[model samples]
Every structure is written in structure tokens, then in C-alpha cells.
Target: MSDSGPSTPPSPDEKPAKVQFNDNFAGKLILPTEEEIQNDPYRRRASSRRVSRRMSKALAIADILEQERQYVIGDIIDLDTIVEADDIEEATTRTRRFSSVVAASRKSQASTKDWRELEEAGDESSGEDEDYLIEWEGPEDPKNPYNWSKLYRFFCLFTVSMQGFCVAFYSSSYTAGIPGMMAEFGITNRTITVLGVSAYLFGMGVAPLILAPLSEMYGRRIVYIIGMASFTIFIIPACVAKNIQTIIIIRFLGAVSGSVGISNAPGTIADIYQSADERSKAFAVFAITAMNGPPLGTIIGGVLFRYLGWRSINYFSLIAAGIFFVAGFFVAETYGPHILREKARHRRLTTGDDKYFSRFDFPPATSLATLLRRNFKRPLKMLFTEAICLAWALYLSVIYALLYMSFIAYPVVFMGLRGWEPQIAGLGFVGILIGTSAGVATDPLSRWGVRRHKVDPETGKIPPEALIWFACVGAVLASIGLWIFAWTCDPGIVKPWVFCILAGIPYGLGTTVVFTNGWNYLLSSYSIYAASAMAGNAISRSFLGGILPLFAPKMYSNLSPAIASTILATLATALMPIPFIFYFWGKHFRERSPMLLALAAQSGI
Candidate 1:
């Protein structure tokens, strides 16, 4: 009382300074602004200011009861904390509003960048050809091949995959037409069959060197459309050819068109997916399309050959080629350097700035010699020097040869031994269909393995070697199929048709692994020359495919089905481990090999 002195009703200047707390705070609160009021050791005073009565009472009891009373900052007993309701309705409302604002801001930012880059990426030049040829910036650039609009890109993907299907189908379907072709051309069965299969392979092998490089120099869409169109046009001659050699020439030319599938399709898929994991899945899809065509075409060909005549096969191909042509018109170009170079051209035109050209742009009036040098040397260089590329190509070639052999041998086996009709014998090829399905069925397991394991820098997430297990399993099945066809092939016991089905297990599955793994490893190691590498591979594989089938009949005649199959199976068994070896060791080999070193030097890797 003496010191307080009736609180000296402070002067106007000294009146209790207003204590400002945060906004939305209420009166009678001990605000931080007023030192005197904040530090005042006064007992609690009642005021008109409202408080949660429950908290106030609890605080009072807590102080008086002195149950080890300890002071605490913040509301020691918050009414909100004690509340029974799960929702902090006010806080939740505020938080949600804040989050919405943040999310919108982020979306706006991303959208701004996405649109800017996409518009910039799409700008292609027409006048100056210098900007038309250059290496792409990278995967992140909107101009990158993988960054294309999904619809346009998917169209290309479908076209590439379907091309593989069409080619594979065409190759096998011609087998069904062998007899008719022979009769019409007045040639021996062996010659017609050889031309039918061999011409297709020859096309497969040779077209790529010319076509793949041309496509690279120009654009993938142009080559694909032109190749398929040319192939379709040639089918007319194949359908109506009056002589055997004319049929052979037409078939070879038609195959040249079709060879684009074998050479370019896998590379096209690689171009579309940026990541290795994605490429593997794409390879699987491509593999399915590539592998599925043989049986599917053979079956359809068998039925069509029986009912519609052999000309229907060529006619069917015309329909497919027509569909591909229409689709190609809409396929967006995905070549990386091409897209970037196009962007540079746009920049130059828009700003009158020639300084924006990328280093990858080709100089004006590049010579055909330079182009040929690039096309011929690049893929062959990759094939010869890169262990990864060479191994995979070899493996794929073996598997392809094996698959084609089945096509050539099955007709002879079932028709000659079990006396089955062409249509019924064609059903024997269904074994390959089954084996292919079985191989594809392993995809889920492969995906799971990739998910379960940590990524390996060497072979990527799913080692290409993992694909080999299926090949080995398939090789064994093929061996059994061969054994069955060769041994029990006589009409007396099990039908020859049964042997075809059984043998297909190995042939189909083996080819699946071979094509898929070869494709995967090629892309993983030589991404720069992926298209050319595949094109070259197609050349090698198709050449093998063509050459091997030409001799199939003779080989079977000389060796007997059992002996021929045994030799083939033994070779497959020996080679089956090759994929596995490369899967694990390929990265090291690629890094250490002189061939790879030379390729890297040439490619400027």
C-alpha cells in the first residue's frame, strides 16, 4: 500500500501503454509491449476479457493443489488440446487454404516452364539445312526424342511394333504359299521355298544399311513410310509374278521394305524411352510383336492359302502396309539432334541470330560420300568393336535362324512324315506361339526382380542376363521339340503335328530372350548409334535368316530331322549361356575392349 500509493493514476503520458499482442488477440492479456504490466508480480485479476472457463479453473486448481507445480510456457492446459473432437476445425481450415495456394503456385511454375520448353522444342526450320542435322541436347530438353507428345509418339511405337509383326508374319506366311508359288513358277519346291524365306532375309539384311542411314539423314518417319510403301508396291509383283526369279526379285524387294522393321523398330523404341528400365519394357513389347508374327502369320497364311489362294498373302501384306503408311503421316519426328537443330533454326529466323546454332549441326552441302561413310562405318564399327553389341547380335541371329528353321522344317516334317494337310501342318507352328507366350509370361517376374533388387550400374536395373534364363529354358524345350519331331515323327505313334507344337516351346521362348536381351544391351551400351546398330543387326540377322532357310531343306535331307535338330540344339545349348555372360560382364567389357574404345573414339563418346 505504501509503495503502490493508490497506483498514482498515471499521467496522460504515462498511462499504461497499450500492450499490442498478435492480431486477433483480446483484452486483459499480459502483452509483451508493456514492461511494467508484463513483469508486474500482481495476483491474478478478474477482468471482462473472456477465457475458456475450464482452462482457467484447471490452471487455478493446478496452482493451489501444488502437485509438484512447475511453470511452463505456452498454454500449459490448452482447451483445444483437451477437446474431445478429433478435428481442429479452425487449424485444419487454415492449413488447407495455405496448401491450396502453395499447390497452385507450384503448378503455375511447372506449367510455365513446360509450355515454354515445349513450344521452343517444337520449332523446326525449313530454310537453312545446317540446323536440320545435329545431336539432340539431351533427355531433359523438350526437344529430346522421348519428350514428344504421347499420342504422336505412341503412334510411332505402334507402327514400329506392328511393322515387326507384319514382317515376321510375312516371312512365315510365305512358307504356306511355297507349293502354289512353285506350281506357278514351274520351280522345284526347294527353290520356291528358298526364295520365299531367303529373299525376305536378304531384304532384312541389306535394306538396313541403305534405309537406316537414309532415315537418320532425313527422319525416321520418312524412311518408315517410304520403306513400307515401297514394300507394299512390290507385293503386287509378288502376287502376280509369272516367273520364279520374278517372284524372288519381287519378294526380295518387298522384303527390303519390310526389313525396316527388323533394323529400325527396336531402335525406334529406344529413341522413345529415356530410361533403361523403360527401354527394357519397350524391348519386351517389340519382342512380342517381332516374335508373335511368325505363328500368327503362319496360322493365318495356312487358312488363307487353303481358302483364298497364295496371292492372298501378298494382298494381306498390302492392307498392312497401307495402314502403316497412313499412320506414318502422323508420326512426329523423334530424332534428338534433328529436333534441337530445328529449334536452333527457329531461333535464327525469329531473332536474325545465326549464333544460336548447335555444334552438332551439319555444314552446308554435306557430301553423299560423308553420309555413306557415316552410315556404313558407324554401325559396322559398333558391331565389330563393341563386345556388348557383337554378343547380342550374334545371339539374336542364332535365335532368329532357329525360329526360321522351324518354319522351313515344320511343313516338311508334318506333311511328309505324318501326312498332314498344309492347314493342319500350319497348326504345328502353334507350338512356337505357346513358347512365345510362355516367355512373355515371365515379364511380370522380370519386373518384380527389377523392383526387388538394387540397380546395377553395369547391366542396368534388370540385367540383360536375366533374360537368358528364359532362353535356356526355351532352348531345352526346342531340343525336346526337335527330338520329338525327329524321333516320334512317324505317322504310327504320336502325330507329327504334336512334335511341331512341342518343339516350338524352345524356338519361340529362345527367340524372345535373344531379341529382347540383344536389344536391351545394344541400347544400354551404344545408345548413340542405337538405330544404326539395330539396322546393322537386322542386316546380319536377316542375311542369316535368308541364307539359313535356303539350305534348311537340304540340311534336313542330309542330316535327318533328329540329327539336324540335335546339332541345332547343341549349338543353342552352347550359346544359351552367352547372354548371361554378357549381362554380368558386358559393362566391364564395353569399358575395357579395344573395339569399344575405337567406337567411342569414332562416335566421340
Candidate 2:
């Protein structure tokens, strides 16, 4: 072959073809000399730039070799001996190919390194931080929460849901034991039920500020396990209480422990799902479990109360708490930072290196003052600033108040007014359950509507408005259920069943809509601050739930069941059109919301 000139130009009509070569080439340059290639600005920039972890690692090893002046032109690249080039031309091409590989690898690796630095920085910042880990800790790292098997997550979800169920159940279980409690304590006041129920609700509300923030410092799994184990351990003291005051104290403490079940669930779920659709499904599952608990609790509490006696409620709670404790051991830490910290821990241990550190490992302590600041300030900020959060909270609160109100009043209407037996009285709860089921059943229609109508031609995303329509249908059903239950109880032949069905209709549909929309709204609107926002919602909804029972008895007695229910149903009816209003104007409202605007701006929306 003829030797070409140093700067030969290509023919005007010819385009230069990309050079290809074997990996094992071990000779000098076909074109530029080593010094010239190194000095080329493009080559220098490409080499200096960040790349894949594997490539960076390879280059680092190559750098060490180069520093030792270890390369022999004729020798094969030892990194992979199988990769070889035959001649000088082939070797030149191979070196370029390997360099290209290194550059590409560095580019890929850069993302992992940048993410790690950010996560570590976040973890070290404060205990209240919520950043998730994104760095790889080798392939299929167990510390990566997403890498955890489905069975593991399901177990966690089940345990939390069960704990929530137990908490709600225990609130009412004392009803069966009230007589025993009164007899033992020489107390006959009707306020004991209120006292017991309020303690649990109060505990739930207060513990999150204390415990949830600590979850940032310690971890979600540890906090849940410790909390639930304490609750189970506290059950022994609560069950054998000789006086009302002792029972009250123990019960309150147990509730504080159980509160983790509800408080941390949304946070955990948020950490798991990355998309709106997945989140909607996850929220739906959680809503089913969370919303189903109260009625199920009442049902189970009544049976345990009647057959096993008042202490049996606590006994069952102890069992549930124990199961949760056992399950908690298997429940991995899902908090993003915690996962990263664990990965860092593993890497440190395996590689015998101190440089590997996770963001979760060094979180600051969230002190009482910080807790107070966060608890008081964040909620106020969210409630006042986020219109969607405020609106959804209001809607859910009203629905919950009505639910608890119904719970308080139902027994009286069926047992006292209609003269039903205790067991038959318990069956009245089925109406509520049936209503919940209806709402759950009707939810798919809303999703289908979203698929059918809300499609954006450009991005193909469903409008959030399509989801709100279910809320309207639910509200209308709630009004109807109220109307039927209100009017059908005059000892007529068709009274009980007709009333039950009517009561269920609205409740089922309405609750379904309420839960679906409320959860989806939180997931969509407050994607980053999902935990704090949901915490605020939990507080508001729980407060309404816990307090409604205090006045429900008096309201039913004074106004009578028909009027009492009608008033509630009427309120629901008035709120029915809320969905339509939101469906039309919701995005505008969100756009106008200062909190949402700030978040959108921050997220570069």
C-alpha cells in the first residue's frame, strides 16, 4: 500500500467512512501520533467527561497501568485477553474503539455518581428530609427497595393494614367491656366510651410528628416494628387494668404505637410507585384496607365483646399486634434514603472501604422543637396554600363525619327504636360495608371513563377531571342512602331491608368516589410532598372521625334518626355537584394555588 501524505483531503464527492477495528489490535497509530491524539481538544474533552461506572472503573485501572508505564504495543489489552487486533492498522483502530468504549461507559456511570452525591447530601442534611436513593449498589441490590420481591412488600402492606384495622377495632371493642369496666371501676358514666375512643384518635394524630420524622432519621421498618411491638407489649397491662384510669393510660399508649400503621402507609406507598397509574392502583388498594377497617373493627369487636367478653377485644388486639410485630421484622425499610444507606453499608462492608456512605446513614435528629415547627407549620402551609388539598380534605372530612355519626347512631335506631337483637343490631353495619363495596365496585367505571374520554392527543394522558365524576355519583348515592334510611323505619313490612339497601347505596358509591378522588388527587397534586400532605389529610380526617361520635348520639336523640340522617344526606347532596365544579375548574384552581404554583415552578413544570 502507498503511504498517504500527512494532510490528504478527501475528494469533493466522497464522504469519510467511520473506521472499524478489532479489540485486540496492538500496534501504533495509523493516523495521528499518541501525542497528537492526547492533545486533540475533542479527544481530551471526551476522556475527561464523566462516563459509565464500568467504563470509569476500566479507565481508572488503565490509568494506574499507564502511570506504571506498563503497556507494550505488541501485547494484548489485558482487561480482556480475547479481544485482539492483528496488525498496526488494526491496533490503531482498536485503541480508538476501546477509548470510545471508556467514554461511553463514563457517560453512563456519571448519572449514578451524581445521584449518589445528591442522595448523600440530602441524607446528611436533616432528619425531616425525604429524598429517595437512586444510586446502584451493584446489580439487584437488596437494599434497593424496588429490588425487593413483591411478597415482601405485600407482607408490609398487609401488616400495616391489619394494624390500622386493630386500632379502629379497639376503639369500639371497649363497648362490650363497658359494663365490666363500669362494674369493676364503680363507674356508670356514659363518657367512658368517648374517653377510650378519643385517646386512640389523639394518639394517632400526635405520634406521626414524633415518629414519622424519626423514620427519616432511623428508618420506617424499625419505627413500625418498635411501635407495634410496644403496642403489643402494652396490651397486657391494658387488658388487666383494675381501674378505668389505668385502662385509659395503657389504651392511649397502645394507640400511639398503632398510629404508625396509618401515618406511614402513604409515605411508604409513595416511595414505591413511580407513575400516576401505578399510584392510583396502590392508593385504591390502601383505601380499601384503610376505609374497610372501622366497620370491620366494629363487627369483629362486637363478636369478641359478646362471646369472649370485654377483655377479649384487647386479647384479639394483642394477637393482631403480635402478628404485626412479627411481620414488621420482614418488612424492609422502604424510605429511599434508608435503602441507599443500607446499600452504602453493604458496599462498605464488602469492599472494606470507608468512602461508601448512604444518605440515610447520617440524618440529623428531628428534635421536639423541629417536630413542633414541622407539625404546626407544614400542615398550615399545606392546608391554606393547596386548594386541591384543602378541598379534598374538606370533602373527605364531611364524608367521615357522617360515617362516624352513622356508626354512633345506628345501634340506637335499630336496637332501641326498631327492637332488633344485639346480633341483628350488629348486622346493621353490613349496610355500611355494602355501601363501601359499591363505591369500590363503581371505581372501575371512572377509570374506564378516563381511558375513553380524557385522552390528550399530544401526550395521551388522562385528565384528572375524569376521576372526579365518580365523586359526584357517590355524593348522589350518599344522599339517597340517607333519604331511604331516614324514611323507611316506621315498622313497615319492607322497612328494615329497604332501609338497609338505601343506606348502603349512597354510602358504597359515595365512599368509593371520595376515597378514589381524594387519594388520586394527593398522588397527582403533591407528588413530592405526598407524605406531608397526606399526613395533614390523615389528621383532619381522623379528627372528624374521632370527634363525630361524641355528638352523634345527642343529635340523633334530639332530631330523631330520620331528621338526623336527612340533615347529613342533605349536606352530601349539596356537595354532590362538587365533582362537576372540579372537573371543569379544578386545573384552573390548581394553577392559581400558590403552593401548587411554587411546587410546579420548583419541579420545572
Candidate 3:
């Protein structure tokens, strides 16, 4: 780093010379200006993922390079000699690399004017019209979502959790009022009544493909606002629907709008929590509601149906939607680009400087199309081609579908065979609720177990495999729980109905842990592309959840109840080895993907 001894340092009045910006250097904390992203085709629409979404995992690696033990303080980087590094280790290597740039950046940051100070002097009269990069003043910058007050962040998470729960709850709760609706519509066919649930699931699956890109374009809060508003407007039609067609169609539309919570919450959670470990605990709350919402909604819906009618479910949804609708307004924008744009806009207005620009803006025509295509294609590509994706998709699909199928199976066992009241039959899923809660309660322990693994040398944090242990254990627990429910729920067996009901505990716990860790594993592995992978999985899971339940009635009617339950337990068992397969080979598989290596290289260090 040293050349020609006895060199004099540049004076404060002499501005630093401009160097060419590297669009591919996404791993660096320092980003290119909004103009750079917009003008360069390669950088447009890519910063949100490469810069913001990938921040937490990227920082874990970046911070390792900054440690005092790794570098000498006197080193200075000459940008002209720096070559673009293709991987994290090379990018991070202490000998004349991006790490040197990082050390030099830290050294010079204290001497420069922050974005705010620069903004104040941004008047056109003050100097030449030169574009300046707008960014968080520092790691603790209040403008950054990660630096938000803990209590307020939790509030946002709570709002997000409700969005997920209410949508999921409504989808399942519709099943509770099927009998009453069928009677009023003069419909005797059970298959016809199931259509409403299928339509809603369809909406849930399809909506996210569109919403994911919209969130990027507008920010999380705008999506939340639009979704909640649409949900509220649609609930009235659902409540007033005169026939099955009206109910089915309205519920589908409702699900499309309400899906904001289910599809987009994880990104927001990542935005707020910089540490993967912290995200685990936060996601646990999300997992509890998303996984258990169906059963809880059914319990409440059954009670409402017994007293008021099936129409009350929509009314109930309306009330919940109304409350969250208002709450949505209070939720801050969490998307990194959107927030930076707003800051840039503010600085422009205050200082009347055209040069004040957010580093994440995109040119509307080309960038939007490219982003949309990426949002649509990459996940499917990974799903079909990537081994890690294929296994998790199958395992998650079975576990997810089982939740929906339970809406039908519970009724057949508790009402058709046991003769329990429709209202009372809803209580069967209590074990599911218990299990889901238990999983959340034990998430810390699960994360702790994962963190016990050797830290990754590059990222300086636990690897994606940290989530696999619980998923493996959860797979077994889920299968066992299903087998117990299958045998114990049969009237010919000596086991009590309570035992079948209690079986949900293991299933619920298994489900919560499996799902929570499953997502975390993806997040850990893919980093930026995690959203694309997750959105694709949501579609498949929703399709199965909706379609599989259509056969529940026939399954119970044709086969013995125990046998039907055993079939489900068997599916769970088949997938039991999936987590184990992943735990061992996940890293290897992840390593093979060129994009993953790029992500690790760019974000790791």
C-alpha cells in the first residue's frame, strides 16, 4: 500500500479525485449513485437485492475484514490498481483488495461531510452541479430501517403478523360455515362447498408474483396499504354474497389483496433485523400466526357460525381488516430504495439541488420489465434446477397442504363419525395451536443449536445449515403426530377423541419449527435471491394446500379414517430425510450455483 516515501497528505481544501465506479462491487458497503444505477443497464433494479436486502449477511462478512487484527491502519488504497474480485475470499483478502478500500473508506469517512451536511450546501449557487451519493450517515443512521427503535420495529412486525394471520385465518375459517352455506344455497354436494377454499388459495398463490415487484417499485408500506384497502373493500361483498359463486369469487379477490402479509412480511422482517439470529426469533412470531391461523380461525368461525351464521365469517374478517387497515397507515416504508429516494427527494426540495440523488433509483421503462421478468423466472428456474429448492418445495408443500386438509378431515372425524357438534368439532385443532406456539417458544433453542455449528470463515456467521437440524427433527415429529392422530381418532380404537385432538401438538410444533427454519435456511443460503425462491414456493404450496383438500372428503369417505390419516403420516415420513439430506449436502449444492458464489463473493466479504 506504500509507494515513494515522504509523501505529503492532501489538504482538506483539495477534493479527492473521482474514480470509476464498479457496478458489480455490490458486496462493498459503499454504493454507486442513483444515476449510476439508472444509466447502467447492469445495475438498474439490482441494488435493492444486492444492496439493501443482502445487507445483514453482507455486513457479517464485511465486518470481518474491518477487524483491527486483519489490517494495518496506515494502509491507503489507490483505486486505479484495484481489479474486480470474482469471489468473497478474494474480495476480502487482506493483501491489496476491496478490504483495503474498506479500510481506506473507514479512515476517510470521518473527514467527509455526511449526506445531510452535503444537502445543506447543495444550493446551486454554492458550487458546480456535481451529483453526490445519498446514503445512511453511518451504521447507526436513524434513516436506516435496521436502526429503528426496537419497540417500533416490533410494532411493525406485529402489524405484519396480523396481516399474515388474518388472511390465512379467513381462508380456512370459510370451511367452518360450509354446511350452513350449502343448506341456504340448496347445495348438497360437499365438493362444491370446497371451491371457496380453493379459490382463496388460488388468490394467495397468484398475487405474490405481482406484489413482489410492486413492493420493490413502491415500498412495503404502499403495498400494505393497497392490500389492506382492497381486502376491506372486498369483505363487504363477501358478507353480502347471495350464493356460492358470489362467495367463492369474493373470497378469491379478498385473498389476492390480503396476501400482502403472507408473501411480503419476511422481506420486511429482514429489512428491520440485521442479524440472521434476530430474524429467527422475529420470524417465529410470523410462523406462529401463519401456521396456526387456519385452525384458530376455524375455531372462532365455528363459534360464530353456531350463533350468527356463515356470513359472520366475512363480517369477522371485515372487522379484523378494518383494524389493520388503519394500522397499515402507521407502518413505515421498509424497502431500502424507497426510503433513500424519499430522503433524496427531501434534500432536493430543501436545497433545490438536482444533484442530490438516491443510489437506488431505476429508469421506469427498461428496469421495470427486467425486474418483473426476474421476479417471475428465477424462482421457477431454481425450483426445477436447484436440488436444494426441489427438496424443500416438496417437504414444505406436504406440510402446508396438511394444514388445509385438516379443515376437512377434522370435520369428518369429529362431526361425521363422532357426532360432535360442528361448533365443538372446531376444537380439534387446539393441539395444532398448542404445537405452533410451542415451536415458536422453542425457536431460540433451535437457533442456538444451529449457531453451535462452526462459523463460516468468509461470512463469519453460522451457515445456512444452522436451520436444518430442527427441520430434520420437525420432519420426524410431524410424521409421528400424524400417525398418532390417524390411529387415535378412529371410533373403533380405544383411544379417546381427546387423544386425537391432542395429536395436533406434535404436528403443530413440527409444522412451526419446520416452516420457520425452512424459510431461514433459504434466506441463509440464497441471501438476495431468497425472496425469489420463497415467492415461487408460496405458489406451489398454495396450489397444493388448495387442491389437496378437495379430495379430503372423498379420502375419508372411501378409506378408513385411520388409513386416511396414515397416508398423510406417510407423506410426512417420506420427506423426513429431506432435512438430513440438506444438512449434509446443502453447502455443497449451494456452492455449485454460480449466482450463489457471486452472492457469497459480493455479499460475504
Please list the Cα RMSD from the true structure of every candidate, rounded to 1 decimal place.
25.2, 16.5, 11.7
Best by TM-score: 3
Please write out the lDDT profile of model 1 over residues 1-605, one tens digit for every residue.
00000011336786432212223311221122234423543412312121122123322222211110100000011111111111112212222211211212222332222322322332233223224323455546665767777776677788788876887788788888887777766766574557667877777777766764465456676778788778778878877777777777887888878777656675577567655456556666676787788888888888788888888987997788778767767767765545555776787689874545543234333444655676677678777766666776777787778778877777777777667788777888787788787777676664344345333443223333433344445445555555555555545555534554676676676566445435544543433234555656766777777766777888777776666767777776677677557646655675685654643453222
* Candidate 3 deviant stretches above 4 angstroms: 1-131, 137-151, 273-281, 349-352, 364-367, 454-462, 591-605
Q: Residue 385 of model 3: what lDDT? A: 74
Largest lDDT belongs to which candidate? Answer: 3
Candidate 3 per-residue lDDT over residues 286-343, each given as its tens digit: 8778777888998999899988998998899899988988987888887765788688
Candidate closer to the true structure by lDDT (higher is better), 1 or 2: 2
Task: For candidate 1, report its TM-score.
Answer: 0.67
Candidate with more favorable, higher TM-score: 1 or 3 = 3
Deviation from native of the Cα of residue 450 in model 2, angstroms: 1.7
**Candidate 1 overall lDDT versus native:** 0.57
- Local accuracy by lDDT, each model: 0.57, 0.58, 0.69
- Weakest ten-residue segment in model 1 by summed lDDT: 67-76
Error in Å for residue 366 of model 1: 4.3
What lDDT does candidate 3 reach at residue 473? 86
What TM-score would each prediction reach against the true structure? 0.67, 0.70, 0.76
Off by over 4 Å in 1: 1-153, 270-283, 343-360, 365-368, 381-393, 447-481, 492-496, 525-536, 580-592, 597-605
Q: Tell how far residue 514 is off in model 2, in angstroms.
A: 0.7
